[model samples]
Target: MEGEEVGIRHQTDGGQKTTYGATGSRPSSGDERTAQIAGTSDSAPVAATDDGTSGLKSAQGVPAGPSTSYSDAVGLSSRRKKAIFLCLALNSTFVMICIAVLLPFFPQQAAKKDPSDSGDVQGASAIGFIFSITPLAQFFGALFVGRIIPKTGPKMVLMIGGVLVAGVISLFGFVNDIDDWADFLVICYALRFVQGIAGAMNITATFAVLVGLFPNNVSLVAGTIRAFNGVGFAAGPVMAGALYDAGGFTLPFLVHGGIMFAGTIWLFFTLPGDAEVGTGKKGNKMFKDSFTIPWSFVWCMTMFICGTTIGMLDPNLSPFLEDEFGLSATEIGLVYLVFAGTVAASAPVTGYLGDRYINPNKLQPPSMLVLCLGLVLLGPWAETNLTSKLWRSIISLVLVSIGFSSGITLATPGILNAMHKAGYEDTLELHSNLGGTVTALWAAGLTIGPTVGTTVVSAIGFPKTNAIFSIPVLCVATLGLAVGAAYALKDLYYRQRTGTYSLERQRLLPSKDQSTAM
Candidate 1:
């Protein structure tokens, strides 16, 4: 390292290395730390970098600064890269489609099961409960992934979860056949719960693998996967609508189950096998770091909002469209194309901008505002004749879709950068922990969004519920904008005047202890 100081290093071989970044030499043990080992506490941090030959490239001359691309410092063979991408990308596409297949029809069926029938509140609340149950299971399942990933490794967990989820998807087909409301409700809830566990497992594992494989290009990786995920979102409705017309309620789920099973088998053949890869006695810390990490809350809020962008619509939106527009299930599913299609296109751009130009955090607030605008129009609460216009609904869906996908795509990469700045090492364990934590928060949002959206819609109707929800999102967007602007200015000052910047301060300047430390 020349003409710079290193703030953090994640080398493969574990060797004593020269430092770069803010100071020409390393800081005292008290002033700095690296990534937390799996079970380790704040003590016993790993310092220095490894040789270039391992999966990660050597960082011998590179500086850990703002301008540096993390992916550029990491390396992978072409074959391995292909295997990782194909296995994970296909998995994401199929999983999202499977998760989405029910959105167009299930709420309508649950609405019918409503015993009170006293308007929409009671039914909406019950239906919301049914819809929310799956993500609720996923919230816990994320925690479960943290504990198991080290012992069984992510590969086994991904496989098991995939197979199990496929079974749940297959079994859900039987629910519509039950005539009894109690049995139908019970079966639906049970299947959703199981599905949530499977989903959490699959998603968490997938994220861990991506993080491990592309530690440097996290933003790009997240963006690419999200693009595929958006495609699944776009396709799910079309597939469901067509399948329902072909075989009624049973066919969509059965087809989804088959697709999921096939994807799982592909993964089993593709992903690498795992040995005992636990960090140490502190292996539990990898799971616990979700709480201990200083900026975990920041990522949590963004991740939650990302999830709600999709979730808030799931419990009630389809039925609202049906009642307001006189649309059939198939038609309702087609309407979803507006939302999912926009997501498919915009998510990748959000990621690219975050990586190539502005900070990922800066991208979020604007997208949130876009979402707020969409929600307002979705309700058509403008108090005019156009309030119920179908075109207004389409435009609103598109905006909401953009916000949803961008929010998710930005959060993962942003957290990785933030963690690196906060003095956490960019290691596989660290990435795995982050994946689990973020997934947990995302699950929480998905659970809460539907439950709250339904309950509120019951009270004020969907239009009013959407209108009111927009208020909070608007507030958050405003705050994020102010904060993001301040940081952007700070970075500009550091880069232009001082000539270089890392997370903490300008690397062109030296720390007070540089004399003694060097």
Candidate 2:
């Protein structure tokens, strides 16, 4: 141990020689003097000499990497970041899977339990409402979760949500009569609402930590996580179907609920401390005072229009498949599995492109253009009653769904970059736990889309209603493309006019991790 001393020597730019010294003893030895010398030799520690390392840890207690001050909470290594991603990805998968697994059982259970129910009760519309309501609750819940998460903490929120989902789902198993069913439904719906709120919070917290841990690769990480989201979507209904057939209605819900419950326990026990707290008053102030639309109203309006379009399309797809092809509930669930499945599949590739090749803002137009084509294909199919026509339409709609999902996936990165370019970081807290706010905005559009689409379809019939709805999609696509093009032209014009894009100097330094890697 006496011969293990390590001293590092370097020459300063000032033409002076300097020697950096550290004992070779591992920080774990609890030697205070050795840690002080080694830790301060590199990055500045977060706490000053007074507050930091109160115990005077030895070199053996110090880590070989950066100091504690430099390390993020949970000590996110690149490896741990990957772990976080996997956990979050599993979280996404589990949530969607839980929702999907119940679809197959619901119809058969409904029919067997109540033969006196009307066609409306048997209709996919009721299921659609059940499906739509949770997301609808999520939309509203996102607006407030930013304030709530910090107060309650992510672990608590996840735990509560998981318990609620489990309890409500278990309750679904015990209801013996139709008279008490309304109460069961209400409890389930309320729990779903709570789940939405917690989901939004968890997503934001997890993403924020990842961003901090891997700032440069945020988009790539997001894309990768989204790819897993597809896996969940694809796997959910299949598992649900298998379980429902083999185990019965009660089993699937209980099993799915149990998985969620397990994930909640994992978070409570394993989630790193000091990763992030919550979106606080400062975040609220930043949003209120600094958040702005980079392209005037263009981006906001585009999201609003697209959100509605997709929301309507998502909810109605089940019914559409049923009415068009005379498909059963199981068949309709398969269709949803395909549609969402496609979206999940394409997210990673599109996200990769958005992060690496294309400028983020530039991603909007191409995605939107493709989505418009997909919507157009859906129009004629809306009126077709032939089973073959329905299958063909399903194929075409899958194509469209892929395009639209790609567009939706691309929008987040694009908006983020646009905001960054416009210097809205301080105000929006865009890189922090403000993901819920962004999600909320998108959800608002979705909420409007379904309400309007449903109302219009009810009034005018699906075919005519779709034809009218297509107009907004096209217009929004056109406007979004135009705005993106304008930004490109403006950047070009500025380069031509001046040697530099702007006279402003760069103040922010790259992070130490990135800097050292470079």
Candidate 3:
């Protein structure tokens, strides 16, 4: 019976297989011969039924299907997927923490000179460069990493990025001893640029992985990820301040680098190796296709605005606190904690709403409105009198966090939903590309925001800059609300008329097809 498929064969009457003798005669019933012939060896293969039950067979005796236990053991379970997602979220949080950790220390770092030399140190422009270079480098990082990911996959990209980030951040500790200001500036700028590239790769790859893992719940998952980032942003400054207080400039960088390195190692082992290049067309065709969805453009613009608003804070906020309130570094960090803490708290809530209750298309106006409110609160309209500074800062931070949670956080899900509705296949490649483009636009805004805010603050002062920024933001929000409402009404009309409503269907169909439908 070597290589023979032996199992119980069921007949139409639901009877088991009957044994036949060598001469093709059936053994007589109630005879030992019949019992001996019917008894098969223990090694005989057991077949499965259609319901995944074992010890069952078809008429022809072929294995019915795979067993349920075997399937459960081999396939990834829901619990395991969530665990992996949590790990990735933690990794993202670490990345954001690394970015924000230096914000509180920038002025001190900028002013430091070699102890042996008593010369004029670098100025605010040097500080500006330090703050802005990372985002500028990220622009290129996002652009190239998007294309490279299709070949290397996310796991390897993250591994490489993690190493680069770890190495570059560790180098920050060494810059403290340099005597020459020019050398110090060059070194800091170079390290930041490399770190930006590494960060871009890590973020781009991580997002692609998340989207690939959960196509149906992109918004919710994206929100969870953002929430983790907010956690990092919330924790980073405080940690950095404490580390700096304990061990000076070197300690924070070294400790963070070690943590990043460890996370990278964890990713290498835990992350699955299923990422592959996208099947969709790239370059001009991809770009052209992205624009086919109206919401894509809106998401990009919204991201840009989000970046700008955040960027405006990076260089200006710390200095503003110092000048206006004379707060110490640790105290300033607490102020930052309010903003990041709020963002962390609100992101998941908004994300959940976006997925379950709020329509992705409708998120833009509300998000913009919230952002405008934050901007206005922080502007000249607020009383900057000494007694009110504390409350003003707290209220403004809370509003900004809420605004960002609703507006910027929804951008990813909104973009993804729009792509899906537009007939694009939900593939890692498409998500990667779109994510990269959006990230790049956001980075561009970040790059512009600090520089613009710095220049504008220098000319018109801080209060005027906030007021000026709010004007355009309010305008954009108003326009977005009108457009979103119009689209909603149009969809309602089509649904009533055709009994099946899809914006993509309406626009994509030819003129002749549309006339017949009407």
Candidate 4:
């Protein structure tokens, strides 16, 4: 199926202002016109004259209008941004809840349906396949979906993906009803693949819309979405266990799927249409452009490493806990809750730092260092059989959770800012394509993590496997720090050689209008 991306933004050239994407642009007939887009509560439209200057006055004489092909209206209010944030947050929460609900029961579910008397290795492999397939499908979905978004629009893609996800997950509740083990495995794999595709489509569209609506708050919006996703992750397993105990496997799927379905329906009725941009020919070129962007590559690599670290635990953690501590499914779910809860609590704070206090580029290396440290600790922590493994596991999970959440929460905003600094136009198509690329790399990492983690653990055991995985994360962190230091030194050297800074130079530089209009 073809998936599309969409977003909304206003662009002005002199006195003429145009809103792009699903909201069609039109030239203003009057000398002054006010345009209002959805997701804002501002009653006063941001007024602009035909000469492309803001009507509002600044302290420093008439400040130069924001220099770009398009810029967010100075008058665009915060109320609208908050409204859009809530929608994205709820959507994120629902999506994660669906994913996490089944995690705690994977081993038991696989064994219950396996006809053959396979050993633990075989069971672990089976679990890996089950968990990894979704991300694998998502990888492909994200790679190709950007090409489709301009044609269909992001709203359609979001709604369609949401519906498909709900339907497929609901079907999961029926997997146990099948008689043959082969048939059951087939059904499970098929559902997961479809679910992954749906997830990719939904996420890509949602982010595209958010960027379109509120470009200034990219980090804040990203953080809020992740925060809710963490909340869903924290809540899903607990709710699943409770429901499973109350009814069976059927109840959890039905309940989770129903909640998602309801949210999807609400989004359909309430969410504003994303403004579609560019023809298919222009969009094709934009897709090509996405690959050419240098920061896109950096962001993708960062995503891949982060994803691998997070996903490494998926297949192995439950089985490892069960073997070492003899924990039940509920207990395993509770262990996961620690990680998810930490993420839920920390993401907004990390996001705020990225958006306001810290430069995202500067934040990345330290975040990765924390992740590496957590991974290193896992080996020794797991071997601490002398004390309660539970406490050790909790401590390890908390450390890892903070690192993982900080890394992910910072990534989108950092990359987006980098792209902006590099002189890329903040267009809907570009944002959508970049979003796809990031998601694709992340999915690829998630796919690799489990497949590799399971194989390594099966061969060498968890401690050695974990210690080995920490190497790549450490390598990535070191590279990021080196690059950041190089950039800082370059900037410093330029400042010392020149009497004035580069930013001051650019600001003092005369505009094209200064010569042409004169």
Tens digits of per-residue lDDT for model 1, 234-277: 78867898899888988999899999999899898776555344
Candidate 4 lDDT, tens digit per residue, 124-145?
Answer: 5665577678999999998667
Better lDDT candidate (2, 3): 3
TM-score, predicted candidate 2 vs. hidden true structure: 0.73
Number of the predicted model whose TM-score against the real structure is largest: 4
The C-alpha lDDT values of all candidates are: 0.68, 0.56, 0.68, 0.68
List all candidate RMSDs to the true structure. 9.2, 9.4, 13.6, 8.0
Q: 1-518, model 2: which lDDT tens digit per residue?
A: 35564332111123211122223423344323333243332332222132111122223343322222211322335676566667767876787676566565665564443335556534444434555676676667666665555444444555565566556555555443444545545655665566566556555555544555554555676766666766775787788888878977677777877888787677666555432232354556434532465542445555566677777776566676677678897777677767777777777777777665665456666666666666656646335443336656677677666666665555555555555544443211344435555566667776677878887877876656556766776776677677767756776777788865532112122335545665
Mark the regions of model 3 whose C-alpha exceeds 4 Å error after superposition. Answer: 1-75, 114-122, 322-329, 382-389, 492-499, 503-518
> Candidate 1 overall Cα lDDT vs. reference?
0.68
**Number of the candidate with higher TM-score, 2 or 3:** 3
Instruction: Compute the lDDT of residue 346 as modeled in candidate 2.
Output: 78
Please report how far candidate 1 places residue 117 from its true position, in Å.
7.5
Q: What is the TM-score of each candidate against the true structure?
A: 0.75, 0.73, 0.77, 0.80
Candidate 1 local Cα displacement, residue 516, angstroms: 34
